[model samples]
Target chain A: MTSSRPRPATIGDIARRAGVSTAAVSYVLNDAPGGARIPEETRERVRAAADEMGYVPGAGARSLRTGARDLVLYVRSDAAQGPLASEFLHGLSRALRGLGYTLMQYGAERDRGLEAARAWAALRPAAVLADDDRLTRAGVELLAKGGVPVVGLGSDPERARGTGLSTLVMDHRAIGRAAGRHLAGRGYRDLAAVLPAGPPLRAMGGERVEGVREAAAEAGAAVRVHDMAYSPESAAEVVAGWREEGLPRGVFGYNDEFSGLLLGALLDAGVRVPEEVGLVGADDLVLCRMLRPALSSVRMDGESSSATALRIAEVIAGGAEVHLSPWTPVPVRRAT
Target chain B: MTSSRPRPATIGDIARRAGVSTAAVSYVLNDAPGGARIPEETRERVRAAADEMGYVPGAGARSLRTGARDLVLYVRSDAAQGPLASEFLHGLSRALRGLGYTLMQYGAERDRGLEAARAWAALRPAAVLADDDRLTRAGVELLAKGGVPVVGLGSDPERARGTGLSTLVMDHRAIGRAAGRHLAGRGYRDLAAVLPAGPPLRAMGGERVEGVREAAAEAGAAVRVHDMAYSPESAAEVVAGWREEGLPRGVFGYNDEFSGLLLGALLDAGVRVPEEVGLVGADDLVLCRMLRPALSSVRMDGESSSATALRIAEVIAGGAEVHLSPWTPVPVRRAT
Candidate 1:
């Protein structure tokens, strides 16, 4: 994929400058312990010379030699979305960009999971970061069979080697627990969770609702549930009808975007926040702090989407498998 | 690259199901308009079959065979960005995703102008949506040279393409003029535009400042320009120091994010909205509605980023170049 750009300075230049051989330069730079028996004095000279001359090794050249590059893949299912989940994507994209790697979003496209498998095989990515863990075992197997490493984000990691896909489950139930814990502590007896209508959001939303319900139930607090369409119009309609259809004293919005929309409608109707209705959102965007009276929300932060992408690129590059760490939700106290 | 799994239906499948040739299906879908003369009866039957079979023609195959697919490229240049430009991308993303085409954010690394050209070439995109009209003409020429249709989003098309790339200018200066006239009419003698510190925002910010100046100039009102970083801490510092510095009676924030941030600080410092200091923002978002004393701002819908992608797709699909209608900024007069 690279063109023949010629005559760039190789490690030979640094070795010559350091009065050492190329082997010494490589050992010191790569930190290949025991790769060479060069004296410490020689290694120091090589490092100083390399730094002085601004000598740098090309990643492409290194990859060609070792058949491995530090690249991470953020493999994701095709998006069947309508600007929904954009904040997550933007966050991931910005974060991944910070980590430094090419990030690509992939999906099999409408019940073509196996075809997605075929596409994944052709790409031969080093590591897989499947945002959606629902990928079939067969999908995982095809990639593993190709000797590609994999890690499932928000998916089951236990089946990684079996299908060659490792999982990093996002504890949706934990988000619910956090939401329940916060609102209940605020001394609001009546509680409800407003969820958006969709397969993806439904699963995550259900976990959150269950957590709220379980916590509220244990506290002997009343729990109600409402479904939403993930739009300003739909949210307004839902909020407008809430008084007549059983308005809870406190509500946990499935996410920040949804919660913000719901809160807007409640305010439009002259309802007092934390008084008539306590509100909670997720995702700490600039707008959250900008909101009048501000918004109380759940903060979910950690290695961003870009970092995930860089890791995937590495797995694809070096053909190495990785264990994963996930960032979970934590409650941020702000005005209701 | 596909595995043993049966591939999904292609144009070939549609042709066979209709007992016609692949060319027939293409002709019917393309309508080739005045080019083809097929019986309405056959057309109806073909349409019905396609719908019943749930056939969405393959993007890859169509691009390969026809030299184009229904996909447009919205390139996010690293060199040029405007105030609240994300609102445009967000709107565009939704519009195009609704029409079905992935919205790719083209990042031009350190390579600048030609870097975007190289990236777009490798992707083999159907068309180009260049946000930065200032990219060297050679880069624009390179994209056109590759047979890729080109369009401009919020850029001066006439200047960028000269004769090739179609333009969709946002005309933000008009927004500035409107804002200036509104503030002057409200009896504010001094006007200030709090601009974000950056290269990308510089050009548009300058244009807005000019427009505001012209309006203030005509109305015989004094006007001033203030530059500050868009971060909360920086914006707060600017506002906090305003008292000793002789604050402007009316402040026009560069965009919603900046305005929103500055507004929050003003409120926190006990500065009243419209009473002590009148304020205005641009690119209305959902949060603007939620801001207490509701935000009085300009709304420039601009071209939807996703729709830009769809249009480029259509051009690649052999449709005429798109004539994007710029979104006008309207004053949403609420509490402010």
Candidate 2:
């Protein structure tokens, strides 16, 4: 069963096998300019020879030859986790693959900053797609200097635009505001918003808290901010503290994971959901429906975001200028 | 904030500033063989010139010069989602990064089979890491022919070895057996193992079911297999059927996500856990602690697996032979 390994066939091998010149093989393989004028029979012979040997044109070689790259690097922040991140990646991967490009995910070096940008630039990707925190002005300039187009995604369009990147800014504040409005409209005047404590999450959490505060102020409701990790113990402590202080009956956990953890903690502490406390989460993850109270959440359309990013990347790859756009989040009300 | 983009510094620029030949600059930049003969002062001058201009050596150009690659492609099957997958990727990414290699994940083209292998080979990756189903003999041979090392991870060590791949055989059966043993030790006789219905999951699930059956047989208990999708409605239907038939008192629902979903369905159906039915999950994801009754699970050491894979990858990348290893799963006992 163990046959000796055969070497990968090269264009020269194809040329020899097809009784053609090396240049003709290269032209046929790469579909080079003026190669269409080659006799159809000769082209077919070259392709057949290549196919017989299972020859694949190396992307590195192709890029070097044509100055066209097939890689699009997506720099992910530390907070790039959960169902939302997965969905976004899947969508982006599909979209990029359709455009004959591979989406490569690189973990952002937050502390390294400019050094990280230079490292990414070293890859010489056709484009770099990143969120706000990962897309610093120096990073954009470095990438752009290397002739790689840059696209930035985040809550702040203005901040992304400041870096001169093609920006697709989604309103995370709107998600929080929607959750706040739902809870406040239900006659819950006292509310508490849970924010996951971490540098990676703080920026988004702060924006969400502001939105909650804005909605709370409009309804003459009070909002308390709780900074905690996404853990059952952390949630349990928050619940205990809320009970001790007699604070709020309505809460908006940062996202579904936090909401799920908090829900479990609340239930463990004998707090009946809705009857005792109402909760809302973001992302509207599938787990939301599986939970006892069926979590209410703000839904961001990752598919649309992915489509827009891919389109911008395609346009930029085609040497066209990019225009900025703003995306909004919608709320889905459920049992919670 | 948007300054006009500057051109990326080239080797010629570095050579000119350092008052050296392009070959000398390349030697200094790449630390080429015999570069030791270059005076320390000259090397320092070249380094300073490169830093001053923010010169980054492109991966493409470097690969061509050194005949070495920096890409370690991780081909993910469709089942690559959820906490377990995320944890595995994070661990692998960190491990590879420490070794100065980027772990690029590509979604496997399962349906395309050998054609998919050809597509991956086109990327000219330094190595390819994939699971059993995706790493076919033809794929392995094709990659090997291109001088690309292949690593396969799955339950079937023999099959993976048959393809001449560096195999890390993780026993899914052991995971299921552990779950079965835990439930049986708790005096639960009748057992049912839930297998998620999908091409990507069926192979692993089948092995797990066999393991459960083996354990059940040892304890003089009966084991039944339930095929369901990873959805709450599917879980609810299974729970409903079990209730109507009075089938089993112990169940293992694939993994924590499925366990959480099943637990919710069981609770909604008024079935008390532990007292009425014992449940177990795999992966022991964070959600296990957050779920009601807390999920009992079979814990596969993703960190160890990732480390081993990275070690094998590094060895292969350094042109060394690969050794095979067996990895076992351990069960964590909890409320359910």
Candidate 3:
């Protein structure tokens, strides 16, 4: 077999086939501003030739001329693959597509700050959406300087006050407060908040613990903070420690998946749920209903992805001073 | 606040700052051949100026010049988020990065055939990887015409025999065969294979059912096939039907997630697992161990993603006639 294969049809190839100039072919294909002046007959010829040759407009060439691709880069964080996160992404993708933009998820979660900004700038995306504390002030500025607007979802909206970065505060504290209040309403005087010990998860975890502490104070109760790795063994060990150190009346895991693991461990250790200890989790996953006792969780009542996409469109259209707390975490009671 | 922000530093800006010609700056930055002949002092000055200006190479410009991006596009399937799939993707990403390539996952699962090929071609990826029966002959040919190689993972490797396409056959039939043999070995003369009824999942489902039928015939047994939607209600309905019409001696769900759902519904319906009906599932998930009585499953003993990446690298480097059956499904016996 010969290694030689036909190269992609270029504007020149289309022009030659259509018996027109390259500029004429470009005008017909790209729909440039002055394309109205071109004859419809010529336009039809160019289009026909392009279709026959299977011509696709080069994204790279278009980006070179316009200095930005019609692409929205999403620098995904480590936890962005969770069920709730997946829903947001799928919706966001569809919303952005409706607005004539493609959402490209970048899986280089470890690349943070200015290093990440540089890599993103190389692609010349129209906008970038990031979650949590992945982007620093300098990173935001770097992207801004590269003609790319940024929309952030994190605990701190004030961090972008002067950086021209639009922020949607996730309010992890609100999630914790909701969980704590639910437990307190159930007549629990002693409470605990369990969170991941990893550095990447610590910032949000800290805010949640603070919310729990605040709720505990309002209820005239005491709250303890416990940190553990994301593993079944770690959950079992935590449950074992609780068994020895006297279990709190109520406890909330960082999220549903982690809490589900704790529920499993607690059951294995012969601990009676609700009667002895009430449990809660946040980011209400479908698994909550499927669990034996049905885990109680907090739902983030954020605006639809369509709404967020419109806001992003506004940011790109030179509308700044955007501050949105899209999420309002609310308690969702189940058996647990 | 002023709407005017600093644009990204360009090669021309670096040239001006370093008091050098544009060509000299290009040679220093792009490291073009013959750059070694330039004086060390001049190179240092250019590098220092570039660092101070925060100039990053434009991916679009580079792609335009070379007519291809150092991107390996993976058009993800609906099932690409499964636990096993995630592991494969993560490992593939790392391996591709080691080979100086970036793996970009395009989440447009609905677009298939020549339409998807045209879209992927616009980005000018070096190669494309797809799963199952997504791409058609025209799609593969269109990509080949544009010098973009394709590597597919699906049931039919012969489908790409003369299309300059590389395929890694995922034998769904083998998965069913393993489950059937496991049930047959347990002395179950009547067996059943359950799968999703949705069109997207039916092709692989059909292949698995055929394999089960083959195994049942060899063992002098009989096999029945059933289809259910991906819902707890659907699973309950299926299980309820078994109670009405005599139950099969053994059953297997298409994969772990589906099978796990079946296991839950079975236990809820007062079905005695293994005793009354032996059960099996594929893609042994972590949920298998966490479930009550520990659900039995089959593990896909496929080559590591690193190995597959190497094979892909070989394909990109001009080696042809590649055929790989990366999976050999084997039974994993548990309490269920």
Winner by DockQ between candidate 3 and candidate 2: 3
**Candidate 3 residue-wise lDDT, A101-147, digit = tens:** 87777566467899878878887777888875678778877787677
Highest DockQ against the true fold, candidate:
3
Runs of candidate 3 exceeding 4 Å displacement: A1-55, A66-68, A78-80, A131-134, A153-155, A319-321, B1-55, B64-68, B77-80, B131-134, B247-249, B274-277, B319-321
What TM-score should be assigned to candidate 1? 0.67
What is the lDDT for A259 in model 3? 84
Error of 1 at A140 (Å): 5.6
Which candidate, 1 or 2, would have the higher lDDT against the true structure? 2
Candidate 2 Cα misplacement greater than 4 A, ranges? A1-57, A108-112, A301-306, A318-327, B1-56, B109-114, B302-306, B318-327
Clashes of each: 27, 0, 0
Instruction: Provide chain B's TM-score, model 1.
Output: 0.71
- In model 2, residue pairs whose N, Cα or C atoms come closer than 3 Å (at least 3 residues apart or on different chains), thus clashing, are none
Q: For candidate 2, lDDT tens digit of each residue in A120-238?
A: 77776777777667766776666666677777766355554445567655566777898898889889999999888987777788888889988899899999999889778899999
Most lDDT-accurate candidate: 3
Question: What DockQ does each prediction reach against the true complex?
Answer: 0.09, 0.37, 0.38
Q: Which candidate order results from sorting by TM-score in descending order? A: 3, 2, 1
Q: What TM-scores do the predictions have?
A: 0.67, 0.86, 0.86
